[model samples]
Structures are given as structure tokens and as C-alpha cells.
Target: MNYEFLRCDIENKVATVTISHSPGNKLNTQVYQEITQIMGELEANEHVNAIVITGEGEEAFVAGADINELADLDTVGMMDLTQITRTSYSKIENLNKPVIASINGEARGGGLELALSCDLRIASEYAQFAFPEINLGVIPGGGGTQRIQKVVGQGTAKELLYFGETIDAERAYQLQIVNKVVDQNELSSTAKEWARKLAQKAPVALRMMKLAVNTGANVDLESALTIEATSYDGSFATQDRKEGIAARLENRKPNFKGR
Candidate 1:
């Protein structure tokens, strides 16, 4: 499908979705719509085993929301916009395949929120992150406030949110917001490499693993154990499970067809 603000390309079972806008790749209504649409297509595309999201230029993964759009919003408009944003982010967060954020540069406000929705984040040395919505006399309308705390504890999230300060890639890695940080020149290659590695895993098991961890995280210990048990039992029923075991016994690589 055609997109005005987003570009998608698939290679080696990995889909790379890039957000590109003239000024800082800021999130807007159209961008959100295109993202959700692209994600839907990717979800159904059997060839795609993993996904990576990033910005067009090296300057920013996304600077924030488009102030041009935000500036024109009334209270009702703001509410509607926030709902759309939330739904779009939810689509990414709930995707069965692994989603990685190749954060090339600045990720602020809603941009940071977008990155938080991904399963993993790999930031460039020049990358910077912040929730600067408070500076605009508003809070992060997306999942930033909640997701950030889940990844980086409440105290750190509170400090970052309250101060509206930008943290460098290293600091973000230290806070566990980003899984890895590499030199600016290595960012794209590193992200693509990681995506390719993830694509090599058994597809059904990868999906189940993500589901088990994400679902378990929100429940009590006993409930989490139950969720994991279900996932574990479900995996054993797949043809890939037998192939994996037989390959191990034969000392050969397993060929999982995602059965």
C-alpha cells in the first residue's frame, strides 16, 4: 500500500519501516494511520518474521509530535488525537512478531512513546530521548508515562517526566530503555543484524515467547505461571516442535516452517 509519511521494505524475512517527514520525522495523524495500516499488512505477511522501525535521516528517529498539528487542536480534537495515537501504539506493542526500534537520533515526547511500544530498542551513539510534553503544558498523551515506568522503574520515569530532560543513548541504555547502543554509523547495520538473528528462530516459539513474557508481566506469579504453561503446551503441538527435537537428536539444524 502507498504511504505518505512511512516507507516499508521487506528483506530476509525482516520488514523495515521508516518514518520520514521533512522536519524531524514528527508523528502526526497521517503517520499514525499509515503505521497501523503497515503493521496490519506485516502481521498477515507470512514472509515477514521480524520488524524494525526507524526514522529517515540521522537527525531524529522522531523529534516529537508535529507542533503544526498540535498547535491547531482544541480540547476535543486533542482527545481524539490521543486516542488514535494510543490505538496505533497498541498495534505495535501487541504485534506477534518481534519489533525493534532502530533509534538513529533524537526521540522525544511522542517519539519516545512510540519507541517504548517496540519489543526492543537499539539506539545510536547520537540518539537522545526525552518526554518533553510537560514543556508544552501537557503530559505524554500516548503510553509513555506508563510504559516508561515499566521499563525504567517509577523513580527514573518520574524524574525524566517531571524534568522533561533529554538523555543520551548511553544514559538510556543504562536506564534499560534501550537494549543496545552503538556508534551512529553502526546503528542501521546493528539493528538489521539483530532482526535477521531473531528471524532465524522458530516463528511459533518466538511468538509464544513474546506472548508469555508480555502477558505474564502484568499478572500475579501464579497467573503468570499459568500463562507460560499454556504457551509451553501450545508450542509442543506444533510440527516445528518435533522437527526441533529430531534435529537435535540427529545433530543437524532444524528447519522450522512456523507450523
Candidate 2:
């Protein structure tokens, strides 16, 4: 399907989705709808093993939500918009395939929330991050309040949220908000390299791993252990597991068909 606010390119089992909305690539209702649609398409496409999300230009990965749109939203309209945005971000977080956020530039408010939804984040040295919603007289209406604390701990999350300060890529990396930070020119290639490596792994195992971790993180220790055990058992039943073992013994690369 075609998208007015997104540019998608698939190659080598990695689908890179670029947010193309101009003037900071701000997220809007239309963008959220397209995101939900594209994610479903990618999930059903067997050839796509991994996904990458980025913005169209270097100036901003996604500056934030469209302020103009927000200005017109009433309480009910805001709630509706929040639900749409939350659903789209949740789809990214819960997708069976791995997703990497290639943060090329400023990722503020909803943009940071979008990045947080991804499985991993690789930011360019030029990239900046913040949750500046407080300045707008509202807190982050997206999943930021929950996901940020999970990644960076409660104290740091609160500090960032309360202060609404912008952080450089190095500072973000130090806070463990981003997995890696590379030179501006290397951002795209680095993200693609990570996605390609992930795509080469056993598909069933990858899915199980993601499921176990995402599910386990929010559960008790005992429940988390059970989830891991179940995921392990499920992976063991796959043909890809057998192929992996055999390839190791034969000293050859495993050819996983995602079975």
C-alpha cells in the first residue's frame, strides 16, 4: 500500500520506513494510521525479518506531534488522538519482528516516545532527545511516561520529564536511552548493518526471544522464568533449531527458512 507520510524500502529482509512528513516529520493522526497499516503489512510479509524506522531528513527524526493539529484538538479529540497514537506505538513494540530506531536528528516528545517503542535505538551523533511536553502545559500523552522509566529508571525519567531539557546523543547514550551513537554519516549504514545481522538469525528463535523478553519484563520473576522456558521449548520444536544445531556441527552457516 502507498503512504502519503511514509517512505518504505525493503531489501535483504529489512524494511526501512522513513517518516516523510515535512516541517520536522511531526506525528499526526494520519501518520499514526499509516504506521499501523505499514506494520501489519510488514508483519505479514515473510521476506521482512527486521524493520528500521527513521525520518526523511537530517534536521529531525521527528520533532514531535504537529503543534498546529494539537492546538485545534478539544478534550475528546485529544483522547481520540492519544488512542490512535498509543495503538500505533504499541504495534511497533509488540511486533514479532525486531525493530531499530535510527534516530538521525531531533526526537522530542512524541518522537522520543516513538523511538522508545522500538526494540533498539541507534542515534546519530547529531541526534537530540527530550520530552518537552511540560512546556506545552501537558505531559507526554503518548507511551513516554511508562516506557522512559523502563529504559532509564524512574529518577532519570522524572528528571527528564520535569525539566524538559534537551539532551545530546552522547548524554543520551550515557543515560542508556540509546543503544549506540555513531557519526552522522554512519547512522543509516550502522542501523542497516544491525538489521541485516538480525535478519540472518533464526526467525522462530528471534520471535520467541522478543516475545519472552517483552512479556517477561512486565511480569513477576517466576512468571518471567516460565515465559522464558516456554519460549525456549517453542524454539526447540522448530526446524530452524535443528538446522542451527546441524550447521554448527558441520561448521557451516545455518540456512533458516523461518520455519
Candidate 3:
């Protein structure tokens, strides 16, 4: 399907969604709508086993929300805006297939929030990450505060959000916000390499693993174990599991059809 604000390219079961609001690539309401629709299609596409998200230009993965559009909201309006943004971002996290962020350049405020929404983040050497909402007399309205806290811990999260500082890609990797950092020229290829590797794994097992990590975080110890048990059972029933073991026995690489 053709998308105006984003581009969708699927190759070998890995779908790459590129945010294309050029120049700074700011997220406006139209951009949000496109992102929501694109994610829905990627989730429903049976051939897509993994996904990568990035920006269109070298200047930004996303700079932030369109400040001109965002600066007019009142308290109630801001609340409503936050809810929609949260819902859209949660859709990516809860997708059955993994979604990776290949951050090509500057990611600030909502841009960083968008990156955090993905299951994994890979940044270009030239990428810059910041949460500058605090400097604007505001804070991250998307799931940024919550998700960043979860991944990088409360103390580190507080420092980044409160200070509104721009850190390099290497610094982000040290904070564990970015999983990998590569040369700007190699960023897309590297992210695709990782996504293709993920696509080669058992799809059912990958989904269950995502559920365990995402859902179990909020549960009690026993409840978490129960969640894991269900996930294990779900994967065990798939043909991929039988094939995985059979291939191991024969000392051959498993052919996973993502069934």
C-alpha cells in the first residue's frame, strides 16, 4: 500500500517503515495517523516476521513533535494528545513481531519516545539523542518517561529527561538506550542484517518471548512464572519447535517457516 508520510519496503520477511516528514521529520497529527496505519498493516501482514523503523533523511530519525502544532494545547487537550500518542506507540511494542528502531540521526523528545517504543534500537554513529521537552517547559508526553525508565532504570531516565541534554550515539549505548551503534553509512544495512537474523528464528517463540518480557514485568513472581509457562507451552506446540529439534539432531540448520 502507498503511504504519503511514510514508506514501506518489505524484503525477506523484514518490513522497514521509514518516517518521511522530511527536513526535520517532525511528527504532526498526519504523521501520527500514518504511523498508526502503517504499524497495523505490518502487524497483519502474514509474510512479515520482523520490522525496522527509521527516518527518511540523514539529518533526523525524527527531531520531535511539530512544536508549532504542539504549543497551542491546553491541559485537557494535552491529556487527550498524550493518550493518542501512547496508544499508537503501544501498538508497536505489543506487536507479535519484533519492531526495531534504526535511528539514523537526531532523535529528540517525541523522536526519542518513538525510538524507545521499538523493541530494540540501533543508532548511527552520527545520531544524537535527547529529551529536550524539559527545556521547553514541558516533558515527554508519549510513553517516553515510562518506557525509558523501564529500560535504562529510574535514575538514569530522570537525568536524561530532566536535563534535556543531547547525548551521542555511543553515550546512548553506554546508557543502554541504544543496543548497537554503527557508522552512518552502515546503519541501514546493519539494522537490516539484524532484522533478517531475527526473521530466521522461530516466529512463534519470538512472539512468546516478547510477551513474557513485556507482560511479566508488571506481574508478581508466581504470576510471572505462570506467564512464562504459558509462553513455553505456546512455542512447544508450534511446528517450528519440532523442526528446530529435528534439525539439531541432524546437525543441520533449521528451516523456520514462522508457523
Whose lDDT is greatest here? 2
Question: For model 1, how does the per-residue alpha-carbon lDDT over 81-156 read when each residue is reduced to its tens digit?
Answer: 9999999999999898999999999999989999999999999999999999888888998999999999999999
Residue 221's C-alpha lDDT in candidate 1? 97
- What tens-digit string does per-residue lDDT give for candidate 3 at 90-129? 8888999999999999999999999998999999999999
lDDT: worst 10-residue window of model 3? 78-87
lDDT (Cα, 0-100) at 77 in candidate 1: 96
Q: What is the lDDT of residue 249 in candidate 3?
A: 100
- All models, RMSD in angstroms: 0.8, 0.6, 1.3
Runs off by more than 4 Å, candidate 1: none
Clashing pairs in 2: none
Model 1, residue 162: what's the lDDT? 98
lDDT scores of the candidates, listed in order: 0.94, 0.97, 0.91
Task: Flag clash pairs in model 3.
Answer: none
Q: What local lDDT score does residue 173 receive in model 1, on the 0 to 100 scale?
A: 93
Q: Candidate 1 has what TM-score? A: 0.98
Off by more than 4 A, model 3: none
